[model samples]
Target chain A: MKYLPLIWAGIWRKRSRAILMLLQIASAFVLFGVLQGLDTGVSQTIAKQHGDRLYVSSSVAMGDPLPIGLLARIQSVPGIEYVTPRADFDGSYQKLDQFVPVVAGDVDSFFKVYEELKTSPAAIRALRNDRSGAIVGILTMRKYGWRIGDHIVLTSGLPTSNGSHDWGFDIVGTYDTPDQPTSATALITNFTYLNESRLTGRDHADMFVTKIDSAADADRIGLAIDNAFANSSNETHTQSEAELAAAQLQQLGDLDFIVHGIIGAVFFAVLFATGALMMQSLRERVPELAVLKTVGFTDRRVMALILAESVTFCLVAAGIGLALSTLLLPLARQQIGFSRVPDIVFAEGAACAVVLAFVSGWIPASRGSRLQVVDALAGR
Target chain B: MSFLDQTFALTATALRSMSGRRGAALVTVIGVTTVVGVLISLLALSNGARALGGSEASPDEAVVLGSGAASSQQSVLTRDEALAVRNAPGIKRAPDGTLYLSATTMVSVDAIRSNGKRGSVALVGFTPAIRLFAPGVKLIAGRMYRPGVHELIVSDPLRKMYRGLELGDHITLRGTEWTVVGIAAGNGTVNDSILRADADTVMSAFGRNTYQQVIVELTSPAAFDTFKSWALSNPALPVQVKTEAADFDDTFGQLHRLLDFVAYFIGGVMASGAICGALNSLYASVDARRRELATLRAIGFGGGPIIASVLIEGMLLALPGAFLGAAAAWLLFNGHVLSTEGLIFTLTVTPGLLVVSVSWALAMGLIGASLPALRAARVPVAVALRAT
Candidate 1:
């Protein structure tokens, strides 16, 4: 209790040093928070996908289209409850850089598949009645300044497009999902309209979505379905929601390693800078530390106090950094668009920053503690 | 002794004394190493991509894109178009006047996991004559297919990523059974992730009648002028011809530039914070050694040597840090190959990256040490000595 003044005086004596260290820690915390939030949000979005839902793609590859005739065969698969077959018409939004996922699904089946969608019955009816009507995510609606019943056209960079951008659809209803904010990056239209108008030939559905009674039977059901088509014209590969999400992420290549390397490099640089600052600060205070020792303070006690001071400084800085991070995320999301940034949450990662901040301080604190009082007094 | 000489001696003495402070020296090294290492890794990523994309093509070669195909994936030509291209004027031909032309298709395939993991693999179907268009591609094992056989060649990277795919291993692709009869290497192009096969086999399997792109070789640089004018004169001919190097650059340039921008943008922002930390520490070091500097000044040491000494010490500390950082980055990312969208590329670490990293560290040290050196040099003798 008596050492409160000493701790306060220590900070006051090197206010600039303390402030600089705090700022350093705060910036690191902010970065960690935002990055972690993004990763977490992307995962959570995928994980939150309706557990009952399943996606069936070509056993051969994702890019290959499944025969439209296979939709009924998939629907006839044993233990299958409901099925929604979607045809992927790959296109871009108004901007060339932005990839807009255009999916053609049965209206009733899609509504049934996404049980969490909370929309007026009239809107759902409106979507179902018009063949060319489209349904986009809530975030997507905000992004493109589109309203219900607005007409939107999408262009394909692929050679299949006619003069200008090939296809257009009317906006019917805006939807939201806790699964992934970026799911709004896609626009869902009627499969019937797509098949009748733009699409040609036997290749109809890109993939089929199936829902079952229990997730425990997911593997068993997936195997049975794949086995059903093993020797047939169009082979199938059925994956769980998680596996599909993982496969999509895998397209980005070794994300776990890449993200880790990036974060590790960034943090390593931050730690180095902090350690140097702390060492220099401690060296300057050697005489002061000696004076404290002479005044009957034990080395261990002095070390603990310094460590505690550092931990406190780091924690405070991290808190400010986290606060700043939360503020920055919405703006970043807005600027980068929902497809890239999504709804990123930073709470859990800020906790990690707090721990890192203390660890960074401890290295220098331990060195400061090991100083010989006599040498320190003699200005060595 | 002259005042300047004395100052230089004092400055050297001070540096030697400071060098003995192992703890402080270690801290400086640690700081500098991290800054340098990170900067180098980013440089490697950018330059490695550039080298891969840039050094892969030949100068005399030309890439012919079909009228509708803006990208390699979109470009497809009929047999007549390919033959027309081959017979075009000034096309570099063998002594028999046979042109160096290869028609190829580029398609992306999903690699099925024998172990339940999925990966992307690029599928390139080319004629046996593809060797002429891509001279850098080399077969490591087995032999090229006998023209019409269902034999396929796998890239070295493809062999590593997938299972049961070796020389003579059979794999079904696009409902057609293909025997992996050979292994090939691209000249650091995206083809490293591809499954190379006969062009006819690939086209028939994928249900495409036309070729994706055609590569043609011209005899001389000046021939391109006549070729272009003649080609433009026939407006109905839906083929755009450009140097093979230019087409490859255009194909991957946007992506490479995007990655470079990201690496630099993120790195630059992070470096600013690190620099701030360096400056603060140096300022503290100079302030603490006030009496030490003042005493040297009182003994007839001048300011210039003092500044130089402090700067040198900071740089010395930084150089070790830079090396440490570079070594660590190399240990982590060097030769590491991973796939994205099915294209495999090794995280190329080169000697040039290390030099860049160390140079960056040295620069940071010089900048960081300047103000502190100035403070140490300008310290008032009486005031510094009078403190405690």
Candidate 2:
């Protein structure tokens, strides 16, 4: 710790070169921080699975709706706690670019099945009483700046019975899940109103969400539910909520592969640049290091000083880079209209910075430590 | 020394000095290589995706979609509306003397991928005239599906991605079993992502009473505007007409834009880091060569030759880095196939992409060399000599 001043002086000796290297390291970590944040956001969205819940949909295709009558049959299955049916309506708000996913279902049953949605009893009653009442997720509410009792209209891409594609709903409440920020982007409405008002495709539910009494019964119940509809017109496929979310996220893109590819490229270049600079700086200071060794500084202390200098360069640059990304993440999320991006993963990033510091500093520091005082003094 | 003699001497001196500082030169080369390699690979991905979207339609074809429809899947046209479009002028006739028009229906069906993930696949239903419209399409295995039968033809790429898509395999759609009779391959078009069946049969199976869109072969490319105006003039029918190429642009424009933005944004960010690294290495080299450069100046060498030598050295180092990076990208990503949302594309490492990558590296090298070269030129001879 007492060698801090010595290491600090070593770094600042070449101000321009040190500053440029600092900028290089900072930029690399900035990319790392932002990409890691996005990667975590996507992974977390798929990873937020309630173990006891399962999603049941048509085996034919995602767009195929199961009969509404199947709700009672699914409810009768043993080990089922609650079941709800949801119908998806893909639409945009006022413009083509503002695509908002809307899901309609029985409000009471939906609340029962998805207990993670935190809503008051008054909001639930309003949704049940008003046929056109809808509940908007917190993110959507904040994004559109909507308040209670606001009537929002969506233009359905699909035609409706009234010969127009306009669907209006009253926003009666806001919903949020404690851990899953992605869920807060969905808009939920009353299925009865959608089924009655829509010009076509009535008496059908897009999928069924069933909460089982025990996690152990998930596989058995999934198979049993599929068996009940086997040989029937509407055969079903049931998957645990985790599996369903994972599959859906996978369809978006192989984000993990792309993120890791970019991160690998950035770090590989950073390591080479930083390591080369460290070696060059150490080579220039060999005579100084020899003088220190001759003046009662041990070889290990010389090595420690060099290592500390390099690690200080890396960690300080990483700190600034991570701080910059943290400040910019919210703006990025706002521009992208995705609320799921969390703050930078500090633990993973800090650990990475530390490892990079060691790797970049190791060879140069060892060489400094192995320097012979007589030879280095004689300018060999 | 004469100008030629000075130029040769400076060039020889720069080469000798670079050889002495091989470590720093190597670092600069590797840094540039990383930036160019990453940039080229990402741009290749964007290019591949754009090609898939753009190659689906030709200029000689036109399509009539329901009013205000953004995509075929969202468009709905009743039989009467489609019949009205069929009667529109400027439509070419096939050898059978029938108008070469195909009413198509697009639907998304749930399917299990080979990796056991459940995802949606696009099922496109088109009239038999589709073979005429897309002449480049070919049946690679088995025969085409017969109309009115519960038969389907899967694209080769789709078959590779999904299960139960092999020849003779049965896929259940809307509770009806359909046999996969053939594997079709399109010429890098969006058709490669779809399953094909008879339009009428698909409508009845899915209980859809409307066609999504009508595609017509125009008599000539110039006839597209005439056909479009004719289709839109029928006030009784609510329809919009566009060239087939325009429809593809509408459908996939946003996706292409996003991919391009991502490619450029990431490439720019990475290139900045590489440039900074290059600048640092070059600055250090100039500092190390202060005395030598000052001595050269005192011996009557012009500043132009000194600056030219540094710039030339920078380009010489950067060009090979660019080549190495481009070669690496080609080795790693050429013909690499990836799928997203059921659309599959292969990364293409074209000569055009290689040129773009090399240009990016050269730009970095030039910018990195400028400031250091200026500082080296401006170093007063007496001050540089008197120091150290």
Candidate 3:
């Protein structure tokens, strides 16, 4: 620790070069912080599952609707507590650019199943009393600047009974889930209104969410529900909400592969660039290193000093980069209209920075340690 | 000395000096290569995806959608509307004298991927005359599906992705089984993500009473405006008309823009780091050569030659790096197929992308060399010589 001043002096010997190296390392880490945050956010979203809730959909494909009649059969299962069916309205406000997914279900049962969504008592009462009333997530409200009691007309992709594709509903409530802020993008309306209004596919839902009494009963209930519809025209596939999320992620594409590929390329480049710069800096300082050895500094101490110099450069720069990314991510998320992007994971980034420092500093540090005083002094 | 003579002398000196510091020069080259390579590869990915979406529709074809519907998935037209569109003036007739129109029904169905996960795949039902409308499509294996039969022709790429899609294999849709009759290739277009079947069979199976959209080939590209005006003004059929290219742009334009933004943003961040690394290396090189350069200046060599030599050396180092990085991207990612939201695109490392990458590397060399070269030019000959 006493050699801190010496290490600092060595780094500052060429102030411009040191600053340049700092900027290089900092920029790389900024990229790292932002990319890693996005990668982890996606994986975590897919991994997060409500233990007691099960998602039941058709075995055929995601777009295929399940018969609403299955709601009663699923509720009949022993472990099932409450069940709610949601049909995807796939509506957009005004234009395609303003797409806001609206799920239709019985308002009361929907709220009972998704207890995480926090809302006012009056809002809940409004949704139940008015057939055309809708509830939106806080993020969605913020996105479009919507207010309570405002009527928002959405154009449905699917045709309705009146041969018109426009559907209007009063925004009666705005809900938020403190634990899962990403859920703030959801907009829910009464399925009874949808069923009565849509011309075709009236008695069906895109999926059903069931609440189970016990977490341990998830497997058995899932199996029983699937078995009951095994031979039916529309076969059902039931899985825990986590498994469903994972499956949906798979449908979205192989995000893990793409993310890893880009990150790998980036780290490889940074490692080589930093290592080269360190090698050049140390090679130039060999004579000085030898002089320190002649003045009673041990070989190990010289190595330690060089290593400390490189590590300081990397870590300090990385710290700045991470801070910058953390500050920028929320604004980026809001602009992009993606609510699920988690904040930067600091521990993972710090660990990566440490590893980067060690790797980039290793060869140069060893070279500095192995220098012979007489040979280095003679400029050989 | 003349300009050509001066440049040649500087180039010779730069080459000789760089050989002595090969390791440092190599590092700078590698850094520049990494930046350019990553930028090109990511741009290629976006280009490939955009090409897949944009090339599906031709300028000669017009699509009729319900007003305000952005995509066929959102558009619906009854049989009467389809008939009216088919008979609209300026629509070309097929070789068999029938109107060159294909009324398609688009539906999304659950299918099992080869990896054992289920995902949505677009199931499109088109008449046999679709072969005339999309002439670029050809059977890669087996024969085409027979009209009115519960038969399907799967795209070659889609077959590779999904299970039970091989020729003669059975896939159940809406409780009825359809046999895969052929594997078709759409020359890297969006059709490669769809399963083609007869319109009546698909509609009956999925319980749809209307066609999603009608695609018609105009008599000439100029005929589109006339055909569109007639369709919109016709009292019987109220529909919207757009060129196939315009429809595709509306559908996938946002996704393309997002991909491009991400690629450029990340690339810009990495490039800044690489540029700094290049600058540091060049500055150090010039500092190491200060005494030698000052000696040349003492003998009447001009500052212009010294500056030009450093700049030329920077460009030389970056050139090889650009090539190496571009070669690596091509070797690793070219033709690499990836799927997103059921759409498949193959990363294409084209000659055009390689040119773009090399240009970026050249720009890096210019900027990286400028400050160091200026510093070298300003070095006082007496002080530089006396220091060592």
- lDDT of every model, 2 decimals: 0.69, 0.82, 0.81
Q: Quick one: ranking by TM-score, best first?
A: 3, 2, 1
DockQ scores of the candidates: 0.32, 0.53, 0.60
lDDT per residue for candidate 1 within A109-172, as digits (tens), equals 7777767665557767888898888888777788778898789877653333122225678888
* TM-scores computed on chain B for all candidates: 0.91, 0.95, 0.95
Off by over 4 Å in 1: A1-6, A93-99, A114-153, A157-165, A168-182, A192-202, A262-303, A323-380, B1-11, B51-56, B59-100, B112-116, B208-211, B216-251, B299-305
Task: Write the residue-wise lDDT of candidate 2 on A1-380 in tens digits.
Answer: 77788889999988988888888888888788788888887677566578789888888776577889999899899999888889886667877557778888788789888889988898999999999998888988988888999999887655566556678889999899776555577788998988888756778888999889988889999999999999888888898987877777778767788889988988998999988889988889999999999998898988888888888888899888777777656656643334433644777777788888889999999999999999999999
| Per-residue lDDT of model 2, residues B199-280, tens digit only | 9989888877778889998899999888877776777776778887777787777677778787887788788888888888
**Poorly placed runs, candidate 2 (over 4 Å):** A116-123, A137-153, A170-187, A214-216, A334-344, B1-9, B229-236
Q: Clash totals for all models, in order?
A: 6, 2, 2
Q: Report the number of backbone clashes for model 3.
A: 2
Writing each residue's lDDT as its tens digit, candidate 3 over B266-332 gives 8788888878888988897888888877887888778888888788878888898789988988988
> Candidate 2's error at B167, in angstroms?
3.0
User: Model 1, DockQ value?
Assistant: 0.32
Tell me how far the alpha carbon of residue B105 in candidate 1 is from the true structure, in angstroms, after superposition: 2.7
